[model samples]
Target chain A: MLSPEGREQIKYKARKFIFGSKDTEGVGKLAAVYLLLISIGFVYLYPVLYMISKSFMNLNDLLDTSINWIPSQMYLENYKQAFQSMDYWKTFRDSVVIAGIPTLINVVICAIVGYGFARYDFKGKKLCIGLLLFSFILPPQATMMPTYVFYTDIGLINSIKAFIVPAILGQGLKSQIFILIFFNFFRQIPKVLIEAAKIDGAGHFKIFRRIALPSAAPAILVVFLFSIVWYWNESYLTQLYVVGAFTSNAGGYHWSSLIVSLKNFENSYNTARSVAGSGMVDINESIEMAGTMLSILPLLIMYLVLQKQFVESVDRTGITGE
Target chain B: MKNGRKTKPGQLERRENAIGYLFILPWLIGILVLVLWPMVQSFGYSLNKIRLLPQGMAKLYVGFENYSQIFLKDPDFIMGLESYLLETLIAVPVIVAFSLIIAMLLNQKISCRGIFRMIFFLPIIIASGPVMQQLADQEAASIPMMNVTMIEQLLDEYLPHVLAVSITSVFSNMITLLWYSGVQILIFLAALQKIDTSLYEAAKMDGGSKWECFWKITLPTVKPMILLNVVYTVIFMSNNEQNALIVLIYDTMLSATGGYGYASAMAWLYSVIESAIVIFFAVLIMGRKDVYERRARKYQRELKREKRLEKKIRKRGERNERNYAKQKAKQQRKGANKKSA
Candidate 1:
């Protein structure tokens, strides 16, 4: 319906529209955006940076009111204090036993369960998944009281079993299901490749162990990170079951339960202050800050390192793109 | 139906199924003992109120009394639920919007993009454990150290409790929530990177402004992702203990007004409400393909026309300016020669 001249005009118009004013006017806009972005970056980063700086300051420097961004001196006492005061090794060991065992179980349990859901068709398979998810949606807090009673009756209370049992059963893996991603990825596996493996008389287990698991490695890794982070960070259930575990020890040496120890430190800091003094001491502020600093360092390091796998998984899962 | 009957599971299939079940025994055993059984036992506990050893050994099955007490008698249940929902609704949108904008900026091929991303992503890593403790401590310390008493005096003199309660808490808690945006930011970055750059080029060809490109091309491409973000945000926000669900649960569980049964009812009720909100919004946005198509088409046409006109004008102006400059230079040269002679 259009003439050559008209078509050419249209093409020219389109080209100008897209690439037009992008260089000059766009620079001002981009600069403003960058300024906004940098400000936000500063806001997001300041708290963690402040904590890291504070961690290096001694008890006295931390208590100072001037709030200098840099310390007057590089005080390593806080780090030493955190290590000695919290029984770092015992807590770290306990964290490993409580957080690690479950993470391992989650990876293995989820792999088999996720693989089965992905590659198989059987009776009640759909029902099992639906029910599993239903259980997942129910808040852990609601389930906690009942689980406590159940575990107490079974004599699994106050032990690592209480934590790992749920993880082993895939109960605690709720947050890391990656159900849709797994389903879509499994479906996309070339039917021919699977069939060829089958024709060679390979059992489903062999095929899964050799082929499916390796292929789902990226997704598995994503799930692995998700499960580990979740299990490591859990406090509510851990606090409920492990309250007794801490009362047996004193003087913050029971750092194996970091969450509980942090709470204890907060309580102690608040109680230690003399409210009736001519100048009331507020050392609680610095001690609280110290506890926080000590608590987050490992997680920060872990996240900074594994951010690559996290991003790559995001791409593979189409979480961002489509 | 045909496939179902024709490929009925045989002995090999049965064996494979057995092996599959065996492989998944870890979860099966765990779920049976730890989760399902506990849940069932919880249900039993919920129907009957069990006073601890301190309160004397008496288990009374009050039927639906606990649920009724929570719904009718307990004043905090309704208020707690309402406030929690309201807070979640407020936070989800705010965080999602904030994250989307940041993700877009971070996705650009700018300087220190990876570092910037790290800055944003760092929050998620430290969202739990010591980081949370530190953040909460700082927030608590700020209440007294920052001397909010001055502002509190001002508020007491003027603003009502509703504003004081909602606005003050929201403002005070915001510093801590800045960290919460990390997950959504990562997701948005991932979504932004997936968008084909050629779409922007095409929009450029049509004479679309940056604003127009965002609306016509960028927004639509990322619609599904927006939904995903919303879902994740709602779920996370609802589950956050800081949102007062923890406090409410603790208060109820500690008091005689509510217990395990009541908590379960409240949780189920809250979940339903959350799911409904998610579904409602999802349907509202994705319900109309025609609306999206129309907007895209209108934007493309408008852009194309303006781009053409602007191009023609700019070209002519540039040509005229160049000619004028050339003439002025020639006249100056002539005048210099005449003066020299």
Candidate 2:
């Protein structure tokens, strides 16, 4: 039989071997978690990677089933076709104008409205809040036609004003959410600060501009980014209002704007093929992918550049009511 | 003094109310002109048979004819409504549970946490309808590396047909669903951060296991956020253009024969059904009265005990004061008698 010291030494050696004296179990757990996260991340990123890869592939490479992940040859022709067909420069400008103006308007107006809701007590405040929530719950589709008609009657159709007008009025797409975010944010600002400003004889507007706006920078940024994205991706409203407005300048066909081009391309392809004597035309997936990539390229770049701010903004905006 | 305090604050409150109205005036106008007016007109449109002409529009009072047609004649409407509801019923719980789990994982003190958050949130930025459509067309929503057919076959053999189909659909579109959960996860993570760490520490010191801690502490604390997430998911998923009801409404609006009245009727019906679903879930999750009632009862008991204690102290003080006065009087009388003798 071994002495007590000898047995202790053996046990210590076994412990050292199993745990490496640095908590090998924790390392193992972390490794498993990271592995899971990385795989899920890859799954999240697959479509984007696929889009990027397939956008550069030629027709032959696209049709070749053996080829995956990377194209046999880098093809510039797809992008060239996409750019020409999409009226790339003009539509990009239009997209900026269409999405940018509304974002700016929504940020300012929503902040004001949210501040009002947050800081003030008034008659029928609950009723107003209930109405705001009701508006949010009511789908835009429920009122789309009437609004379309209203805009048409007012000669606002086929123009950016159709979008800008509502935005100016603080009723743009998901503006209620922005308002709520700002409301939540402004509510969290200590009342004592505002009271001090009041005692100093600062006007309400001055206090808001100086104190509230500066402090709610993160929420404002979040709302701005979200508004830009929503407006950029807004096909339904654009389709309802301005479908064929600029077709005369672009070509005999409708102007192939970024998002609308995807749908239009299929229709144009079908018609062209039918006119040229082919009854069955397989939709070209590669060109479609290329167009989609171009559409989201600006957004992806924006995300990459503002990634830190975007992530931090989620915490600061208090959307989860923390 | 009371009147002075009340009047001073009341004047300030009135002034503040005016400022508040001034700030919200634009939104109020927007609600009236853009939202409420449009809604009222939509109801009117649904009630009429609208005819478009070169110079003007004509409207004839149809009186619920459009609604009847939707229920009785339109197979597409029925099918779309059914599928939309079923999808929502399955998707809401799955989304809430999935996002909560992801949020918990992301909340862990892990390396490269910011990177993981960015990767998850990237989807919200680029998940436009066209891009999603392209992915769906390419079958990219499914896992490319796994053989789903074998799993589907196994599920089919073991489960009922409807159950198998729903499960398989969820499995195939698992990545897409995960993408949809990006914003939700962020919301949940924010809520999770609000949970005080001391509560967990206390639980652990009391020898509570991790699972018990989650049930007793985490779940209750995050219950309100869970309801918020459910509401958000329902509204978002149903509003999506990919939803069958929205698609049906869009198609009806564009159809040459359907006209504005029929489309309006369809939209109104869809909204009603959507509202019904929302109310049902709200009541199911938020209607429980036990937690609230218990808290109220506790508050009442505490208030009653405080009042009782206050009364007892006041009575004792009053009795002591009276006895001291009587003893002083008795001493004065004894002094007067001694002096006279």
Best by DockQ: 2
Model 1 lDDT vs. the true structure? 0.66
Root-mean-square deviation of each candidate, in angstroms?
Answer: 18.3, 7.1
DockQ of each: 0.27, 0.57
> Model 1 over residues B177-288: C-alpha lDDT tens digits?
5678877777777777777889888878878888888877778887887877777777666666555766577556555656556665555456567667777667866774
| Clash pairs (backbone) in predicted model 2 | none
Candidate 1 clashes between residue pairs 3 or more apart in a chain or in different chains: A14-B205, A17-B207, A18-B204, A18-B205, A91-A256, A320-B191
The alpha-carbon lDDT assigned to residue B303 of candidate 1 equals 100
TM-scores, each model vs. reference: 0.77, 0.85
Give the native contact fraction of candidate 2: 0.73
Looking at candidate 2 chain A, the ten consecutive residues that score lowest on lDDT are A247-256
Candidate 1 off by > 4 Å: A1-20, A23-25, A56-67, A123-129, A173-181, A242-255, A268-283, A319-322, B1-41, B54-57, B140-169, B251-290, B293-341
For A121-170, candidate 1 gives per-residue lDDT tens digits of 66677776776655555556556667766777685666777666666666
Candidate 1 TM-score, C-alpha based: 0.77
